[model samples]
Target: MNVRREGTAAKAAAPTKTSGPPASLREAGAALAGLSAVFLFEMLDNSILNVALPTIGRELSASATVLQWVTGVYAVVFGGLMLALGALADRVGRRKVMLVGLVLLGAASLATAFVTTAEQLIAVRAAMGVAAAMTTPGSLALAFRLFDEDGLRVRATTLISTVGLAGLAIGPTAGGLVLAFAPWQVLLLVNVPVAALAFIGIRRGIPADQASGPHRAPTDRAGALLGTAAIVLALLAPTLFVDAGAASPLPWLAAATAVVAAVLFVARERTARHPLLDLALLARPLVSSGLAFKAAASLATAGLGYLVTLQLQLDWGWTPAHAALGMLPQVVVLIAGGALIGPLITRVGLDGAARLGAAAVVCGLAVYGLLGRFGYGWVALALALVAAGMRVVGVVAGTNVMRGLPADRTTVGAALVDTVGEVTTGIGIAVSGTVLAKLLTGDIATATWSTQQTARFHEAVTRAGLTLTVLAAALVGWGISRARRPGAARTASSPGH
Candidate 1:
């Protein structure tokens, strides 16, 4: 065959084998709507559980420690499963796994409503977490497979972001409202309908891609185990530290194990015929740098979120509803910014978008740090500056990192991004929460005067906020430092024309 003719033939065969969803506008719209339902399920799960916690504790007589587990288990289990399940989605079928996750999550939610005891509730919570672990990677992987074009992916992701924002806005309020009208059962039960809807839509909308299985080399079982162990233990580290701290054997032992596992994972994957993860791929500057940038951005966002909520409710005495409402501006800006940045980045390039976004995070965190360190007040007034700053930080960094990578790696990429983000958030909240709690404990003990006591309380609260903001700043700076490597310049924006 003529070399040029052979090249042309290969190109012709590629479209037939690898075309995504139908190119028709209507087909694309249907697919996006399905993805929106998936987003709703995820966001609702993420945001609604907080309100349900108080109710959960009340009904089950759960201790403060156990209550924390209610939220943290989901993160731990989901983080653990990222690498393993992400590869599963690629090899088995993203559409199949995604739908299964939706159904499982919904069913777990429904079952959680009837828990009569703390252990039952904890068990159900773990089940719900596994469901989330299964859900996110597959849905993200499908987005990559379903929309192969850069512009289309951006449009889809932007809409997905919008669904996320809406869910975040509505879930807490909806949880509050549900509790007011119904019992604690209603909190978990509400997920049933949302997840079911997503499951149905996904079943109908997503087409089956070719499967990877026995025909390919054996699966990477050892790498999966090691990587899962590393991530899961890392997420649990902070909570464990709450009890163990640095001096205790458990936390230190856990960390040592993770480090050893990491070394083993690196060694095994380097030589395995069918390694669990392709560590070599991450060695690429494009992969490693993008991962770092995204991780930093997420850490800043989570820190800002925790600090804002604390400052509003504890320091400023806002009602829970008001506390949730304070997030409105950030949500609005994040939604808008996330949608717009894809196209802008497509024009501007990845590194430019990343640098621009990282700069925004720096500004936002600085303002937040100042506010946290100063005198506090009424909710509406105190947030006037800090809210916008945090939101801008969230949007710019979130979009920049996602746009920096390739479509083929999206599942592992997204899971890696999410794992780093949640782990950071968990650690930040755990550390900051500890400091705030300890300072309060010490100050209340050593009060010389009532006047000084009130001032001390405010000061401790301010310091807590400052702590998180400082951490946020450090992460954003790290993002800026490592961004120039490999794929950080791609700028694949979501939700665009």
Candidate 2:
């Protein structure tokens, strides 16, 4: 496994002219601000939609399946296209690709405001997802151009990451606040102005993508398309199965199609001249573990977000705003946890930090499983632990993965990071959504369920959450253990190192 070297592929592909005024703290701040706006909006969109979903369903008369698609489709499309687009960004220009993405995002978001049906809304969300895929990788990759020094770059990365968490933390609150005074469509429209602002900032602050000399390899269209097909099929199956009969063949057919697409994608990657993504990276423990751990973190955070929003609004009869406010404690802990990760890493090595994070997730899940029967107050406490765990995993995993990658492969590596995160988040929501639907189906089918049934439904939801969290926790622990192995290589330039 090749450790990432400074100024290898990235420098060659997106070379910065050194002749002008040297990059300053001001430029770095500007760059981060622009990128943060884009990241925050994307994260906010997901969280806000989760909060507003119940309301949308009531208004549109959407079925449970349509609601899941509204959320899951975004992640699926975003994850599917990012690798190909990331490669394109590296070859063409990150700034240019990002600007195009912002424009598309703004337009799509504005169009979504007029979507009158559940199907139209789902389609618009998918378009937004494609735009997000284009923007996210460039948002992170462009930081390399803004900050020349490794120390400065790492600091910028941390801030960008923290802001992402902040977006997650604030989503429910923001959505709830908006829903109080306006229609739920406001949630989709809000992105229009945010995207426009991001566009202006990025166009002014971000440098142009200089051409890499003629030796760069060609893009892998086959691998990219196949991978996208696989993801679309994979994400579609679970949502479809949730509403279908146990004996239905559609779910099995979709799952098999996904498997076939995945196999073909892998086969194509192994032989492609310029693969959409390199399979060899998985052979390195650090890169592989980082990917797995990030997925696990998403499972804990996104899954919890989906479940809690429903538990508060649907089961407990809380207003959207009230449900959003109920999550304040978790957000607070997420902020604190982000602030403390550097110190914790200093006290404990990366491996130790990850283990702590994995354990925290498990502890949080255990609390939810055991004591969630008491009240949402207890669930909030569990959320705090999960938030802390997310912080630790979010910080440690990305840096370690980058450290393990070859510098030339940085663009793809970075894209994969975001892809893993988005994809797992989608999976998390799907899995949790399925479980909740299954648990509540009988209750929901009754003309009117008793209060006892409602209470039981809530308990069942919590238990299911616990089951998912435990499974996620185990995956995270396995990744951490793999990363700790003696042969696991490290990059000297990695932030925590």
Candidate 3:
């Protein structure tokens, strides 16, 4: 098997300087808008849809399990196919693949209006998942390619994420409001216009694949299959655990299958010529550490959001509307935190920003575990801290990962970052849910709990929250150690290589 030489790898990773003036976000213009829309759709789709699930169930006469699949299928498909599609984009054309995805998104979303059955809706959602797989990774890769300077990359990423985070923060409330007057189908129909805007902006703003000199490596079909299977099973295992409980053997079987498949995929990649993902590239300090930070942030964010939602509604007896409002501290921090990115980077550098942000996430989780049961103020504080930390690490760590990879591999690298986040988010929620199921003797869905049941619920929340805190802290600690290594700091600071 051939390995990329150290010098060759460095040369490939270095930014190619042009004779013209340096690139800026201003020059990106419509391309940034297009990328932002792509992210917005990814973040908003499920959050908004979750609000309409009960309505969807009632209208379609769907069962509880089927309603869960309406959302679960999208996540499973999207997470599973991202790496394969990202590799395809690198070999083919990122812009071309992205445009095709936009068309599919619009078409599938339009199909919602005609769907009367749960099965049909599920199929439509699965198609949208495919579209998401094709586009989400490229959004970051293309943004990185748009600017030669690391600062510009960070700024561009910050801007794009702000839009996406805004969508995530507003989706539930917006969907609730829209449902008061409009049909649930209208929630999906909104994607049609979003897709159109993205298509127009990308077509006008980005150049064709041939213009930038696309990669010509042969596609690795075996690696793609194995990798897809591994990811799909890994993602599926969490849902099974949440729904099936620990007593069931199905989730364990899925998990073991995922591990075996992942091992096979690694063996294949190590030996295959023109592998879908070059394993050696991932060994680089920046790449691995950046992914760790991203995983930590995602784990904490998803776990905290899930636990807190349950706490407010199920444990504390708050209404859904009130709980949504209760979450404003997090929503506000995530949206308003964009302004802090540039200044934070300016003061601490990317490595510093990531470490600080990661540390803050650990601290926030600890606070929630220790003091969240005391009062709402504690919960709000915990939420704001985690959101602020995630807001920074989400942008900086991703930029660092892109910087560590070769020009041709940026899309795959982005996929890896996203894949880590997706997998860890699932694990985080699984851990929280599994613990609650094991500890709370009463049904969580009951309208009211007995006094003893309530005490057990509080104990479950504390134990689960602390468990997640320890896990997140371990990941952040590993990330910090990786960043502090001899040459990692230099590599992170100097983007030109």
Candidate 4:
């Protein structure tokens, strides 16, 4: 196989203005509408499933272990394939790839909704993971191409993040509403119409964005396979430990395989002419630091959201609809925080914004841990604080990550952020769920509990909150150092301080 030189390929793929009228509200409106739909679908798919897990388990007679796989498998496959698929989007046209993904996602959702068995549902969900990998990076890459100016790009990113986070924030409420009238399958079916509109938007609204010139390298098959396998094994191993006994050999085997695959991936990427991920890109301080903060945010929030749902619906004996309503405050705060991102960044600079968000998270989680046992009302307030902080940090971190990346590598940048999110989200769930399971002496679906078990469960929640607080504090410390470094204040245009 012939390999294109890196410099020549980079020059060929360099940024060029799209073939359309200059960036205007009309164009941005169309692009945002499409991108939001795609992002919303992906987020809703993940969050809605969390609310439906118990219902699905009851219907399918799924064991605790099988149920874990049902949820965890999607993240494993989606995150694992993201980098490779993102690179693929750059090589092909971002819009073209995204349109295809939208179609496939719709088809997969239809199939998943109709599945009769737990095993079949998991398999179809895995297919949806593949579809998400194809779309996630492409959506962000297209947004970059759609808006050439830095200000416009930042604004577009802010809106995109807002839409995606809203989906996550509202999914339980939406799912609960659907389940009130329909079966658990409606959660899976809901993606179809949204995906259909997204397909039309990508096809008609978003302009084409593909690398030009003759020096592009062929797809990196070896690196893609190795990277995908490494992530899947690594993420899957933790879920096993969460559901299966720690004494089980399967988790150990999976971990070892993951390590081996990861080592081989590093070796292959260093030598491969067209690596799936540009290893050098990962070394940049902006990229690395942004990823660290992003992962930390996801790790803390994803697990907390899952636990909150369980606590409300199971421990507190609230109905699903009521539990969903309980989440509204966080969603409202997130939207407000999203709108304030640009102003906040301008006021405090990028690093300062991240530090502030981190500080808020730490303070909120600490207070929640101390008082969460009092009532669900207090827990809602804590979640609102966490959600606001997460939105502020998330928007800034994304802007920083994308701003640091070369125009030629938008898809790679997008994929890196997403992969970090998916892995850490899985880790958060595994750690929190495993602790709860251990304390309760039952599965996650336990319908009844003894007073002693309930007390232990509260202890687990408090421990999880404390752990997240410590992590948030550490992130703020790192951000402060990054801000204080010499020459860190170079560019007003750069998102990072």
Using lDDT as the measure, which candidate wins? 3
* TM-score rank order: 3, 4, 2, 1
Which regions of candidate 2 are displaced past 4 Å? Answer: 1-27, 49-72, 110-123, 144-151, 172-186, 213-215, 245-247, 309-322, 349-351, 375-377, 433-441, 445-463, 490-497
Please tell me which model should have the higher TM-score, number 3 or number 4.
3
lDDT of 4 by residue, 1-497 (tens): 12558777877899976666446646667667888888888878878888888899999999877887787778888888898888887677677778888888889889965788999999988989888999988787677667656557667777887788778877877887888889998888888998987887777777565347111678889998998898888788777777575668987799899999999999999999888778886655566667767777777677778778888887788897788788787778887777787787778877777777766666777777778778877887888878877887777776667766666667778888888888777777777776676666655467788887788878988887677667766766675565455534343245422
Index of the highest-TM-score prediction = 3
Question: Which candidate, 1 or 4, has the higher TM-score?
Answer: 4
For TM-score, candidate 1 versus 3, the one ahead is 3
lDDT score for candidate 1 against the true structure: 0.64
Model 3 RMSD in angstroms? 7.9
Residue-wise C-alpha lDDT for candidate 1, range 424-450, written one tens digit per residue: 766766665566555554433332436
Q: Against the true structure, what is each candidate's TM-score?
A: 0.81, 0.81, 0.94, 0.84
Model 1 TM-score?
0.81
Error of 2 at 83 (Å): 2.3
**Model 3 ranges with Cα > 4 A deviation:** 1-22, 489-497
Candidate 1 ranges with C-alpha deviation above 4 Å = 1-26, 211-215, 242-250, 318-322, 375-409, 434-483, 486-497
CA shift of 338, model 3, Å: 0.7
* 10 residues in a row with least lDDT, candidate 2: 488-497
Root-mean-square deviation (CA) per prediction: 6.6, 7.8, 7.9, 7.9
